[model samples]
Target: MTDQVATTEAPEDWEPSEVQRERNEWRRRRTLRSAVIAAGSTLLLLGIIGGLVVSSPGWERVQATYFDWDKAVSSFPAVLEGLWLNIRVMALCAVLIVALSLTIAVMRTIRGPVAFPLRLVGTAYVDIFRGLPLLLVIFLLGFGGPALSLQGLPTSALFWGCSALVLSYSAYVAEVFRAGIESVHPSQRLAGRSLGLTYGQTLRHVVLPQAWRRVIPPLMNDLVSLQKDSGLIAVLGVVDAIRAAQIQTAIDFNYTPYVVAGFLFCCLTIPMARLTDRYARKKGYHGAGGHL
Candidate 1:
């Protein structure tokens, strides 16, 4: 009876039935049609908005101020030079922020009375920094830290500004890490402990790997934001892309340099955003928001 049933079953290379083939063709056509319609509607909407803008009275002046080709070409070199600094600062701050935030997250998650003070300090740090505006923190560190003239500390606004970025971003990212850590099932920890693993070993080996994987999408989003906000170091007298643009704008009152800077930022940010979306999709997340 088993042999008979096996012989009756369709083989791996068997063709689909007529109905199944028809259904598959219908699905393919439907997908193609939907894609075409979506593209057409998008283009139509953009064309309408663009026509309105171009027909406006001040269109010429707006174009000259914000989109002057010559000005953009001329300012490109300086802004590109300045952008290198933003990249370096952002890279350094990102590394520091991840290290510090992970430590704080671990501290917050530790149990027992012996760890209470560490947890309390971690909580206070997150609360205070999260509540304070990032720009304000940058201002305080950039100006106020230098004013103190502490012997061992550097007075460069760039130093303090980057420090402020690390501090402020770590608070937000620590919460992200903590959320990921908490999402791990208690059974996993118990299993690790039952295998003769210590608490620290359980967390480091069994827990952190999973938590880090789950939190990557949100972490990337935060880093994308960090990349853009790196431009704010310009406020501290750092000659970053935005500052270079500002200097060019001052020379001739043309805003094209500012537009160039903005375009460069978008170029960096959009790819990161798309990669986050791709990763989220790969992890079975299907929504506008992706979180652990």
Candidate 2:
């Protein structure tokens, strides 16, 4: 009984060493100090900006030109139409990107004789598009389409914008897909094979589904980026939200329409950002073996 008691007590008395405890305490204090300093700096900057805005003479003119509701409302219909075009472009681009990215990702992951060349092609595509700016991609698609003699392509401003978006975004999505695929554990693949599943069958049934869930947050981030990048299409003379706003402001010589357009973009993006955060939290909790 004495031996049993000693054994039990031994485990209970195993505290951290004093030096380790002191180090941990120091880390905690350092973190707290840095957080306070950051917060104080942010508040100081805001106060300075507030003082400047209150004292500035041009504040009223700036507000009138950019923030007047009546002028913004008068341009509502055109803005709504432009927003619809933006949505259509985003949807089409997302579909094409997902399909292309998945195909290239699969090619890159496959083992055997075919993998090398396929990966090379996929790498080249990703490198080229990612290295070039989105604006350049849009301009090339819009202005160079006819030169390439591509047939059955839409000549409408919206079509050109959508094509450019798909081309540019597919490269980015492909890399996201490759990363997700590579993150899947090799043991998972071996287990599936041991259970008599073919390589393709295991990938389809076991791997891709898990990889896709893990990739949702990054993909959602990319989607948000594509939403903002859609504005770049305006350079192609596409009548998207930004272009429509610019046209209205140009004619009226008031910046109110531009403000309305900015608000519209924010309205579209903020909800998506919230949704992505919620989903990411849920995924993290699920992964942690916590209740959803």
Candidate 3:
């Protein structure tokens, strides 16, 4: 007994208790039940409405408007051309918006007396753009361009449309950039400073890369919104998708072409929405591990 050595016990790994496990299972079941109920209710409502619509005389009118194959096919090429214009406007605007947004975001993030004025200007820009309707903005830009001495700068309807879009969307995108910058932790900033990097260097080389990754989903969503908003350029008589549809409608004296246009818009938006959702899921998964 005198020669016996003391034995130390190792710490056991922590595990969930039975009660905790039951609680988690219950929560999971509750979430599943709610989702199922929502899906069932939606399907039931859709079924009821579909049955009623199919049985009604007005169903024929709806079908004629939405499913007139001849009219839709006849207008298809013009609609496709308009669709191309929409794509061009969106792409150009996206480039300009990204550049402007980055500059504004960086200015706003700079701390000190210099930062306040820049931030104020950025805020004003965002407020003005976001407050106005998209249609109004397009009209102003399109019609006012000559007055503003900007008409001859580009001259084309596509140029005017892109100009308006970039002006409006840049403001919104700036906020996204700002939010991404703000999301980077102060500790990380401090760590960068401790590593002898200057503020700008740290932001440029370290923080912004992470922030860009975090902000991708929202940026994608904004791009999708911008795509839809491009249609507003039609108010400028730019012969965009909506305008093409209107022209077809007038020529054929049928509402079917308008329905076709609506379908085209859905075609444009749906893919972008799906892409955004995928990006959001990927972002969430990456974020779950805690700080960047």
Candidate 4:
């Protein structure tokens, strides 16, 4: 009796119940099966369409024109040289577009009576440019700018084409900026105001920084579209990648140069597209509060 010791039962291992484990396994299997089916079905559909096209009578001519690997390889160097001009123009336009759009966005957001004219101008700009076809804008600026022929006016196709891009893209970007600014929590604005910040100071120091972050995905998307649209300058005889490709095609009697140019654009755009998707997904979960 004296040597007897109190005994205690050991706690069981903490683990999910059998039913919960089976449910999780089932869900995992279901997800994997769905993914497999989706991928397989897409591949099958694409293969079937490709087979039908290849089996068609025009396939030979289409391949000769558009898919000649030899011509594509031969055209790469010339297309790349022209692409450098496109890249430079794109870089310049991107800077101008961002600057002008931000200014317009701020003006539009102003509520003071004194700001009425600026707001009206900003609204008109957005409406006009957003509605006007991009190609029409390019054609007007590209051809019309040089036709003026005023002393000291730029006569270069590249200059006017880039100007057209800046004007058109700025309007779209301004709307994106405006939307981002409005999405800023009202509490943030109030907090800035309470901290002795003027409206402009508050917008500059607080609102815009957050707004830009939230809108980065859309902005990047627009930039990518602009990047590709740089090819449109070719129509103005700007000698960009597309123009180079067209010239090469005319010489060789093959459309493969155009394919090369398209491939190059795809290479540039795919990374940007992936990054945009990643940013969108991250923002979906983390959002502006993550910063605070």
Candidate 5:
């Protein structure tokens, strides 16, 4: 039969190995060719898009308003100075939020009738702050605090804004800590107890160390967000970077100062994001089979 003749004429079994090697080599070459073609096409498309945009009538106006070199140069000093306030507030809030959130998480995790009311308070605190819009909290804290006019209570806009930032972030971060703590098996807690460790001692030495390692990535992410929200303090009439930008824009009748401020914020934000990614990779990242 024709089928038998075709099978007999095919390459010998010994030759098939050589054929497979050749086929694999051909596939590699094809993949490389495809990648190069894709890269070239993408570059070409980008060039066309760029050319069209550059030739538009509105491009000149946009460049003058948002990219004026002279305006950017003038705006840098005030914006940089104003950004320092944000840095200070964010730093203080970071420390306070971490300490407070850990306390809240611990309270929530304690299992006893005596601790029930404390646990309920912790749960309510997390839910209220996390559910509310961040801007609303900032508004209430910033405006409402000053209106209270309590003698000896800090009336500074900076103080109230920092308080709001601390309050809201502590709630979110408490959940992160609790999740990390709960991810540790119950046997670990029991083992500590069996070894004559008190609950407090076990949490201090065993549970927290591991939980902190597990949650570092999420904590870093939260910190990054917190750092960025430092700008929101501007709503309280604190002269942060965004506020400085607004003043400059009003004075010059150009939007270039806003761009400069945004650029500075991006400069800081990008570094934090990179550091978070680096640490997450170093720690094996919780989402990717690293324990929560």
Candidate 6:
């Protein structure tokens, strides 16, 4: 028996069976065919739309007014310089909004009769700001703030305009943060408390870290909206990108500079939108298009 032993083993270069290989090849062909069809259909639709637009009677006038290459080139430098101011304003306001909103959220979420006053203030703040249109708030602060002539305070429209932005956005973001905090299981808080942690300690150590993770996607979306609205500071004569575009348009009545400014904003927005979608997908959230 010891002299007679035979073993059967797979070769080191084993391959799929014929049926499996055939199935794989068929799947690959089907996928390629589907992609070709989809792409062809898209190209056909785009071509048709482009042809229709080009054939329109007003196309030439529209192009000259909005798509003038020379105007865009000339205005690019000023518009870009103005954009940096918008970026700086957005950055500073974003930081303030985060801190203020988080404080409001914590105030609203805290329990007990002792916290009733804080909760009331937070609730009132959210209701008032969220109900008011943001543009209106900016107008009030930008135009009316300096009229008060308060001592020791800056009267610059830029300062008040940014303050208005921070106040308005903080209201909306506080609710988002509060929702995340409340979404956590009550057991988490109980567990923290059971470990002899104070309520604030538990929230700071356990609740906030988890809540922050859950709310990041929504927060990013808010930031994108903030980026776009930062251009609204132009209403206060801040000379931001939109304002710079306005100046160029005012010069020769050509709307090309406005188009250029819009294009630049879209450039910033598209990447942020894609990043948000990627992050949401990574966290297992699917959109209306499902996995695709």
On lDDT, the candidate that comes out on top is: 1
Which of 3 and 4 is the better model by lDDT?
Answer: 4
lDDT of 3 by residue, 25-65 (tens): 99999999999999999999999999998999899988887
- Poorest lDDT segment (10 consecutive residues) of candidate 2: 283-292
Error of 3 at 80 (Å): 1.2
Better candidate by TM-score, 1 or 3 = 1
Worst 10 residues of 6 by lDDT: 1-10
Whole-model lDDT for model 1 versus the true structure? 0.95
Task: Give Cα-based local distance difference scores for all models.
Answer: 0.95, 0.84, 0.83, 0.90, 0.91, 0.93
Cα-based lDDT at residue 147, candidate 3: 58
Give the poorly placed runs of model 5, Cα more than 4 Å off. 1-49, 286-292
- lDDT (tens digit, per residue) of candidate 2 on 1-292: 9998877775765889999999999999999999999999999999999989967999888888888888899887787789888888887788888998898888888888867999788888889988988888778888877566667766665577678788778888888998999999999999999999999999999899989988988899889888888888888888888889989898878999888888888999878877777777777734322222
**Clash pairs (backbone) in predicted model 3:** none
Pick out the ten consecutive residues of candidate 5 with the lowest summed lDDT.
Answer: 283-292
Report the C-alpha lDDT of model 6 over 145-168, residue by residue, as the tens digit: 999999988999899999999999
Q: What order do candidates take by lDDT, descending? A: 1, 6, 5, 4, 2, 3
Better of 2 and 6 by lDDT: 6
RMSD of 6: 3.8
lDDT of 5 by residue, 24-135 (tens): 9999999999999999999999999999988999999999999999999999999999988878888899999999999999999999899999999999999999999888
Model 6 global lDDT (CA atoms, 0 to 1): 0.93
If both were scored by TM-score, which would come out higher, candidate 3 or candidate 6?
A: 6
Candidate 1: stretches off by over 4 Å: 1-13, 289-292
Q: Using alpha carbons, what is the TM-score of model 2?
A: 0.79
Error of 2 at 155 (Å): 3.1
**lDDT per residue (tens digit) for residues 158-220 in model 1:** 999999999999999999999999999999999999999999999999999999999998999
Model 4, 1-292: lDDT tens digits are 4334323433466589899999999999999999999999999999999999999999999999899988988999999999999889889999999999999999999888999999999999999999999999999999999999989878999889999999999999999999999999999999999999999899999999999998898898898899899899999998889999999999968999999999999988878777777777787834422231
Model 5: colliding residue pairs: none
- Selected candidate, larger TM-score, 4 vs 6: 6
Flag the better candidate by TM-score, 2 or 4.
4
Measured over all alpha carbons after superposition, the RMSD of each candidate to the real structure, in angstroms, is: 2.8, 7.4, 7.0, 6.4, 9.4, 3.8
